[model samples]
Target: MTIGAGGGSRSNSRSSRTNKYSTSKLRNSQHGSGAAGGGSALGGQPLNGPSMGPGKGDIKHRFEIIRKLGSGTYGKVSLAYDHKNEREVAVKLIKKSAIENKQDLVRIRREIRIMSALKHPNIIQIFEVFENRDKIILVMEYASGGELYDYVSTYGSLPEPEARRIFRQITSAVLYCHK
Candidate 1:
């Protein structure tokens, strides 16, 4: 991800404020066959490999889809149970057709690569990625803690200490990414 430079200075002060977080480049990497690697890819565990995880036809067989968490133009996210590990996971389903152009596809692939490479506790963990003819499935760590929006809406505002703690964690994750 390449950060873009902001526009030139404008006569008006109001137009001077530019978005600092603008991505200019999106790079894609080839993920061979969407197959899981045997060793470290499985989180250092010795298992049946990626085959043990859910695939196209046997997705429901391996993982019990609890319910739909949310949906967007890409696809829907569902809460699923990993029958093999007996753990809940969030499955992000992205339709192949939803990606209109090569750029969009590259962006998605780049996102997958970034998620797979990052290993920070504060960030969501992506366990495995599955792709078939029609959809791409991202098996991710289930976040039991409710959404921040919901929490803030319900509680109005967080206490100073708690807010600081959360801010610290967010900054730490951002620092790790920068590193």
Candidate 2:
């Protein structure tokens, strides 16, 4: 999830170009701090365009929280089950209060906009974004194998073949972003 958005063993920046999603009500909202909490605005259009999570419920209704996957400065990720998809997903939850200012919020939303536009196989896919009064939740493709750095750290270096495979995946994602 966020590992691709500057949260992993290797950090990289996405392009500066504007994405169509940036103009959506969710991204352009004057105050989506979600500080008070409750219900999702879901922007002007419904999330995922009709086929989406509920518009008036806690994120748990659609994604059952499994366990904590990881945590970063801005948010925490939990492994969750997508009831609708009948599969696992990584739920990234960011509290609007955790954000210091509007600038940081803009950067966060920009990353979301960029990530939403991506469809590369090697990259994580963002399925839906749920915004309540205080929290912004993102349901993303689950990487059951976990973070590459965690594997390398626990196993003390990957075998050549495994390392190569991981390298290829990283390079493919990087190249996709470059394009």
Using TM-score as the measure, which candidate wins? 2
8-34 in candidate 2: lDDT tens per residue?
423223223233223212211232322
Tell me the deviation in Å of residue 40 in model 1.
Answer: 28
lDDT of candidate model 1 versus the reference: 0.55
Per-residue lDDT tens digits for candidate 1, residues 1-179, read: 11111311111122221232122211112211222211112222211213334323345345555566677898877765665555666777777788899899878878887878888767777777766556677877766554556656777988998677667767877999999
Q: Which residue pairs show backbone clashes in model 1? A: none
**lDDT to native, each model:** 0.55, 0.59
* Model 2 clashing residue pairs (backbone): 34-133, 34-134, 37-133
| lDDT top scorer | 2
Alpha-carbon TM-score of each model against the true structure: 0.67, 0.69
